[model samples]
Target: MTADKKSITALIIDDDQMVADMLGQILQDAGLNTIITFDGKSAIKLYLDKKPDIIFSDFLMPEINGVMVLKAIKALNAKIPIVLFTGYYNQLMDELKGEIVKPDRILRKPFIQVEKIHDLIREFFPGYEIDA
Candidate 1:
């Protein structure tokens, strides 16, 4: 049997443990299973193997960077949503858009409101109810 949309999986890729932990907490609170990795290489491997419903990756990772991860994810044809997350969205989004805006969402770091990520997921995959 397949899992329901509300329980969709999410992959979080970043070298920072705090970022990964926070994202996982937010995603888990929203009812989705969360998978995490610290670099582009691992992100790509897990992405293909697990087939997550969405991915949120830090743009400035050391190895293979977010853009490279995005490229690899795109190549996988997983058709999953990808979010390019960065502390400096203005600096990177403009430069990277032509190369990789194909992502479902480009999010600025420090989230401001932690719930926003869940909100975005709710908006993107509507009709799925988030658990309380």
Candidate 2:
């Protein structure tokens, strides 16, 4: 299903406040509403409560990590596109291999580009334009 720009909501989970805020701003600029969370424990609750159109979660976090968060969300809604962002990309991917709940995309921390984020939104919501 194609989501219109105004109707799409993005859930951004990151232990670091700066990263979460930056990602939220990027999403908002792209015309998607965003909800930011600081931990996986709260991430799940927000996910269920908000039922965002898409999710972007940091791979490493206290209590529960991105993988765990992905599993929890998948258990509730398998169709939601969840992108896991981490600096330890190789190790995280190895751990996630053959998992029942896998991320739609794994973006490397310190390397993510605004264009890539915009591209992901376009992938899920075709015809939606990113603000210049």
Once superposed on the true structure, which residue ranges of model 1 sit more than 4 Å away at CA? 1-7
lDDT score of model 2? 0.90
Report, for every candidate in turn, its global Cα lDDT versus the true structure. Answer: 0.82, 0.90
Clashes of 2: 0
Per-residue accuracy of model 1 over 1-132 as CA lDDT, tens digit each: 444755599999999999889888988887889899999999988987898888999988896988888888887774778888899777676667567436778888887686678678777687767774
lDDT of 2 by residue, 6-121 (tens): 78999999999999999998888888899999999999999878889999999999889999999999999999999999999888988898997799998898745899889988
What clash count does candidate 1 reach? 0
Clashing residue pairs for model 2: none
Those runs of model 2 whose alpha carbons end farther than 4 Å from true positions after fitting are none
Residue 94, candidate 2: alpha-carbon lDDT: 89
TM-score for each of the candidates: 0.88, 0.94
